[model samples]
Target: MRLSNKLSHALSCAALTLAATPALADTVWLKNGDRLTGTIKVFDGGKLVVETSYGGTIPVDWKQVKTLESDRELMVKQDEFTGERAKSLKAAEDGKVTLINGEAPKTVELASIEQIIKPKPILEDLVWKGNVDVGLDYKRAETDTDDYDVDFKTTARHGAWRHNAEGGYNRESQDEVTTTNNWNAEYALDRFLDEHWFWQGRVSYTRDHIEDVSSQRTIGTGPGYQFWDDELGAFSLATLVNQNDYEYKDGGSDNFYSLGLKWDYNRYLVGKTFELFSNGELGKPIGGDSEYELDAEAGLRYKVTDWASLNMKAEKNIVSGAKDGEIDETRYSVGFGVGW
Candidate 1:
């Protein structure tokens, strides 16, 4: 009879332990007024172990805890660009709508929140696009010059493969039409090596022409490095060597060298960019002494909708010796495009 009584007592204790386990998994309010909801794995020696549902173990201090409760939900925030979600606990007891998947605790003003609902993480593929532009320009020097240009660009990306193609045509007053074309293709295999460093390689080609003045062509390939990666922004550096051919007026042929930096700044109001150029040149002039050129440009892009945008760019030409001096080129156009 004593043996049976002992077995019954042991079974009763096991049942009570199971029932109390979930109760200990309740919400914990810290002395600093922070709130957390998870299964408490340890609560001894003024410390605690919380097994969060998002699959992580957190250790916290008992002194930092104010009051422990059992009926509140944990909230978090998310990144708008990367669609990455992160969780954080509440810091104080206030009537505020909390983001359940954000990086930090956010006090969503009652007036700002149109509605309070469960937030879900956004999962979507990267977007790809294609565009075209047609415009007219008036050019006059010692002679009357009138020109019209039609440009088209197409871009496609799937996984690591990306391709860009551009072509343009310009007609001069002398009934001479010049055609220009350029293309770039790159394959990016991104490796998340501890979240901070990456390496990439790209190949590109360019061909440009101007009636009788000059015609230029180039082909290059190189590797690049990325140092920072976050929602705020990132920086990268690359070096490339191109085989360039320049044919000038008066039947003169010369070769030029190309080298420059590619900077990406997506932090402030400016959107996105791509710049490739050479400032220093080693080429003979047709009639004058050899000259140097400084070529740079800034472009602004505004997205009016998912299918359209406006692009405006200003280019500068600062040459050591040239007729009519340096000139600024401005182009503005509204275009409609589609992407996947």
Candidate 2:
């Protein structure tokens, strides 16, 4: 009896292990009758992402998918409806899925499916994400040039409010002669009114060690639109009327009113291993010596791991009507950084 009890306990343990494993629980069927087994990550832009143990993360063509099923609870959106919460999904007739919602199960055609995603839990109310990058160069033979650049950007969101801040420092010298020295910082606050619209208030300050311009300050506020924010990417645009103040080293100063446009955009591709982004603000002065100004950056990040990435960027700063003349500078940098 003792031996029989031990054998029964071993068999029970094996069954429990198999049940706990993620193997082949989620499924996708194609029009050709071929089927794939994996956990569904997301369905966006005509591609269905699935995470498989053997194949890693794979993107399947949405058009060729006949039906799909998953034991995971998900929110499915279709037509003009907000969305539907389902305890699970079951493959139904060809090109359809049955969403098991308690006692009432609903069938939806694959064509009518607009989006499929796991619902965000309330615990995600306070979330933070950001990254830092640096660039350094030195030369010993040609006049002993030394260059340094560092920049950081971060975003925090709580409920309907979002905060963004970015700052950078740059200095270059050749043979103890300072050619460039400047640092700038900016902060912006966004109060989302709804899913798409928001109000933004921002302020920025800059200090320069150059001969002509010594400092700059700006304050602005306006309305904006968030086109989308999701696992794939995010994009937003805003227009602001700004109050600007500038001071030069020779005790010269100027203040002006300006209108500016700002845009922030980013996109992730290929299972989130690659990212493309561009963000900037451009403005035209109304009643001052400055004509137009621009500050922008565009970049690409190749993720080497979840927290580390290799990056390349091009940054541009142009002040068309500075007291000294048109001030234009462009820089290219390659660096590695960590993000979360």
Candidate 3:
């Protein structure tokens, strides 16, 4: 009896190990009654890229796919014309996926599918993307002149939360006299409620000796909407209520409140080799001595490689209720930088 029990226990352990192992194959059924088993790499431009053991890599039109079965969870979205509905789903063997709603499993068709992306770990999902640009010039003459400018931006996303940080500095000197020197930094965090709606909080600080401003700081929060977000272009708008603090070069300090409206837009053209973008904020005071403020930038970028680009940009900045000779400033810069 002891030997028989040992054999049964060993068999049960073996069965549990087999059940816990991940499946090694993914299957796709075609409309023409043909089936293929392999690993799906990605889906883009209405094409599904798959790697098979027999065939190296196959590009199948999204329309030709009848059904797909996989053991991994993936993100699925519908076509653009259909409101771009999206969900996270896990597939079973019989070409069906169970949605998060706990409803009965539903069959999905290829025609309605826009994208299928594999799941990533929480830490792996925090991907940062942006660029930097710098410009410098120097002239050695009777009186020496030097100018330097730098701009940097980065954004990261994980799940429904996104974070962005940006900063820039510019300075020029002639004959040991500072002609222009200014710098600014901003940070923002956004929480997404859906594909097109988000809530954001922002903080910014600026110091500009050229404009006679020692420092200006702001904190704000608001809701935003993505009007268009696709390969061709994107646009977003938001309104925020902000508290602003100011310190002047002449030894004065003040605080105020404002209603701020902001706009961000970008476009990619010519096979995505060229990009144009603009963003701006306008603020009107609510109950303080401050009047109105504006900050804006527009830029164009030309891609030179996968990681580098050439850029030209113009910026405008203004603040109300500043000390004498401190109101507004503008500058233009051209440089090259890298991004992901």
Candidate 4:
């Protein structure tokens, strides 16, 4: 009885060991190299016991085992366009699957792919300079004039600041032989105070000659706030003070100071300015005009490349006192420029 009991205990332990082993699924590669589905029950020295979907166990030689498949699903959805499919068994080992030409197979570890789908760098950030533009203008007082202009401009940015220099010449010979010449130089510095609030300082000089009789020299400085900075574009608001010295062949020299608001919508666009100014000189006290002036301008800008662009502007000037006059001016220009 002791021998029989010892034998029974050994048999029970053997049965428990067999029950604890996991049942594996079989991946059957067809003769034509296609795949079929089944489960594997036992794999001994030289034979495999496979369980088919029809609920029968069949024994086959190990030499006939063309492929093996895990029961786990190993596919991942790649994109919204293409659909999903079973990753090849090789992909499961590598932890990643790649579908090429919608059919070829490639595999990579999941950790190796962490950087693949990340955001790409912006194209605008990579550019330093290039040029091109076309524009139109119209101005009316007692007489109306129409003008068309084309311009090219360029710019460059370095470490903490950028500098720009540009010049353009235009001609309008309808009623009078009027020609316009303009040159501009500007410098801007980007400053960071905290995270959300930052500051910018800009200095710009401009020389404009109109109709050989009127010319203006302007120098301006200002502080600006950047509200947005991203790959698409940037938006900022600035308060500026400008000094203008005007020389007219008929009129005397006039000096003016302007306080204005400026906005830059994008790398290639700018808009909206409202200016209030005071002329420093007094003509006559009793019957003379007041020295205060108001000016407003709106314009559009386009960047052809990092270093070139075109601009169109319309401005209205209103003055007070004897020197008070209303002037409507429209100008279009393309410029080639460089900066750093």
Candidates' lDDT values, in order? 0.41, 0.85, 0.74, 0.43
Model 2 lDDT per residue over 237-340, tens place: 99999999988887888888999999999888877899999999999999778889999999999999878998899999888867654568898888887887
Cα deviation of 309, candidate 2, in Å: 1.3
Local accuracy of candidate 3 as per-residue lDDT tens digits, 239-282: 89999888878778878788999887877666457889898899
- Please rank every candidate by TM-score, starting with the best: 2, 3, 4, 1
Candidate of highest lDDT:
2
Instruction: Give the candidate order by descending lDDT.
Output: 2, 3, 4, 1
True-structure lDDT of candidate 3: 0.74
Per-residue CA lDDT of model 4 for 33-89, tens digit only, reads 545456544333234445566644454544444444444333222321122233333
State which candidate has the highest TM-score.
Answer: 2
Q: What does candidate 1's lDDT look like per residue over 246-332, in tens digits?
A: 555447655555553433332213222222211111222334332644433344445454345455444342334433232223334
Which portions of model 4 miss their true places by more than 4 Å?
A: 1-131, 135-148, 152-155, 164-168, 179-213, 267-326, 331-340
TM-score of each: 0.40, 0.74, 0.68, 0.40
List the lowest-lDDT window of 10 residues for candidate 2.
Answer: 119-128
Clash counts for the predictions, in order: 12, 0, 0, 18
